[model samples]
Target: MRQYWVAPVGPFHTADGTAYATSITLTDVSPAPQITLPANMLEIGSEIELEASGFFSNTATPTLLLGFYLGGVAGVALAASTAVTTTTAAVAWPFQLRYRGVVRSIGAAGSIVGQGRLYLPTSLVASTTRFIPETAALRTVAIDTTVAKTVTVGAQWGTSSASNTLTCQDLSVRLVT
Candidate 1:
């Protein structure tokens, strides 16, 4: 069996006095319905995007691990937030992780903000962007159909402050093969 999944498309405009509609076809082999793989297993030479968002706030900030895992025992780790600290305040954190390669090249980024002391004892603000270099030797581990795997994208609140609120807005995996 095969399936063609078309995602939502709209708001496409032609402002140059010329407009055109284009379509691309994607093919996929049918797999178990209960465990749906957006495009399928993480094949070699494939690119995948893992997106996730969440909200967090704390009165007595604590350490947090917001990341995504792509395997079981041996796998790739796409971290959106690593050892992020929550202060005595409320803030929303959203993140995205990307993996592309024959051997996988992984990267991650997100919105980070805080009031007063956070992450560090001193005030600091920096962007978080990481990418693995693409090379001939690059390789990404695949999900073994026979064994269990842990491919999850989410945030883990280590401890609670006065009001520690952790909410996951969205989590999705898209394949760009």
Candidate 2:
């Protein structure tokens, strides 16, 4: 059994080319795309960002749902009240993850099997709701790496059952670093 997952896009390099990120291709067709990387499990002194895109068949609208811990984490299936549409989108939550080895087993686990990390260990559930009406590909997630230890990032397009999901190459190379 080979470890492999199918994504529309790629796990590319970041701006500094140091860290990496990935995205799920958004199209007019497909299942609703949903992704999450729990909270409170990142190694100290780590800088990272997550990006998600849903392939919309038609340009009706996009919805944003976030869930995690620390300061700005929310639920996965975000409130119906909160929805958005764009080419690309990103969310920044200050967090630290604890499970390094576990989270990096997505590919090996195969497809349709969700994977995650813990950014907030002890208590607390999530944070706020900051939505962008429009999102572009290139520059999605932005974090300083000083505030958060770990974070969960994901998105869903109003149109799509399966939006392709990918991560930065650096991250793909090593799900947990």
Each candidate's clash count = 5, 50
Question: In candidate 2, what are the lDDT values of residues 13-109, reduced to their tens digit?
Answer: 2421111122332211111222223343333332223333221122223343222221223322111113433333323223221211122112212
Which residue pairs collide, candidate 1?
59-88, 61-86, 103-138, 103-139, 104-139
Q: Which candidate is the best by lDDT?
A: 1
Model 1 regions lying over 4 Å from their true place:
1-40, 71-76, 91-150
**Best candidate (score: TM-score):** 1
Report the Cα lDDT for residue 58, model 1: 52
Count of backbone collisions in candidate 1: 5
lDDT (tens digit, per residue) of candidate 1 on 1-177: 745342321222222111111211111111111112322343434444544443444556666554445441124443333455544454444333443223232222111111111122212232345333122232323343333344444344556333554544444455544
Query: In lDDT terms, how accurate is model 1?
Result: 0.35
